[model samples]
Target: MEFLELPKRTSGNRTYGLTSIIDLGTPTEDLKNILNDYHHIIDTAKIGFGSACVTPNLKKKIDLYKEYHIKPYCGGTLFEKCYYQKKIPEYLTSLRDLGIECIEISNGTLNIPMQERLNIISQIKKDFHVIAEVGSKDSNQEMPISEWKDEMKLLLEAGCDYVITEGRDSGTAGIYEKDGNIRSNLISELIKDIDSKKIIFEAPTPKHQMYFIKEIGANVNLGNVKLTDVLVLEAQRRGLRSETFYLEDRECKLPL
Candidate 1:
């Protein structure tokens, strides 16, 4: 019922909806504070790129994150370690043991073959609400738009809940340029090939979010968002401010 105003926008408890925050080396108390202040605005939390593996209070605070109804998931880097250590089973178990049910399987840092990548997706989808990323972290590691389209297709066929377009934290890979803006033609091309509903574009900057909202409408799934930017992104999503008011016009809607 809450989504009636925007049927494309699914509410909380959904596999797809809202902005996902990345907690990169943040303390448990800080995470708790965010939940306290912005519980309703936040959705998923990534214990950021395997740094959760190094945090002292990660296990103890995991339940607290769950208590707030925010689904917690390990970053793809953590999965990579488990994948390389030949311990994906244990890795997935550890994540589930810690009360996490969402996961991101990525080849951003490591070089994983397509069949192996497909296998990983196949296994993870059995339990976790899975999100698969399709790109390398290195700026020079360019995935041709055509190849990315094919990869996205395979990931979808493999039963991934969401597919990330590999916009690294800096918003400088794939369709994004070095200054955190998107490449228009590239965005058009990707949108034409990949179904937008099942894809999350990594938009780490306000400018990037604006471009994405203008280009793709409000339900664009954005990831790798910094913890502090959570509220800002929420406002932008709702067009509650000047930054995104023009977005409503872009969508051919009358001003609120």
Candidate 2:
């Protein structure tokens, strides 16, 4: 069976164009089934929020994700809780015990000072693949573009593998408006200075996914995606869906 031609996507152990699935609490068995089919498209899986601490068969699940070549790590909220409680060592120890190779260091919900955050990243980079997130999870705490850029630059220099712009799992905070629309000006200012390849935009909803794929090309790194949407997001990336059907090698090929 011949497959129809469409836009080409970055494939195999991707670094730039990554699809990071947010696992809110998918059963281990169900995750195994999904990964059997979609593992090739999934670059990483974030055990969203603090669910990693309470999830059943967590080590098994983490090992399973690793077996499928998916990098599994707890969400930043867990780190925030640990930081707030002054248990950073315990947190890192727990991650190591679970055979996790990656971790997200974020201050989305907490007020960890900028220098402190950078110090943590600098120290943690030696032990794990660090993904540092910027922006507040609270909608009212809007950050200026200059601060966003400054923080992102410092995070990267502090040795972060990637910097995630917070859109939360709801798509209603951080880079999004209350109604879930993207803040275009923020994105424009972001990519103008920062390398798009090094930033992960949290796009949990279909519309958000479509917007990023269309606006940032097929290879944009997206996070907080629901497990069920992996194939759908991949389809969008490849222009197999109507929303991105006109994409040709990352360029729009509209009917003339």
lDDT tens digits, residue span 1-256, model 1? 3542431345666554557877787788877887899877777787878787788878877787789988788888888888888998888788878878888898888898989989877766878888888887777766677888898999899998888877777788766766656767766887897878788888888888877776777667788889888788777776765766755534722122
Question: Highest lDDT among the candidates is held by which one?
Answer: 2
Give each model a TM-score.
0.89, 0.96
lDDT of each: 0.77, 0.91
In model 1, the clashing pairs are: none
Best by TM-score: 2
The lowest-lDDT stretch of 10 consecutive residues in candidate 2 is 247-256
Error in Å for residue 37 of model 2: 0.7
TM-score of 1: 0.89
lDDT of 2: 0.91
Error of 2 at 6 (Å): 1.6
Backbone collisions counted per model: 0, 0
- Tens-digit lDDT track of model 2 for 49-85: 9998889999999999999999999999999999999
Residue 157 in candidate 1 has what lDDT?
Answer: 92
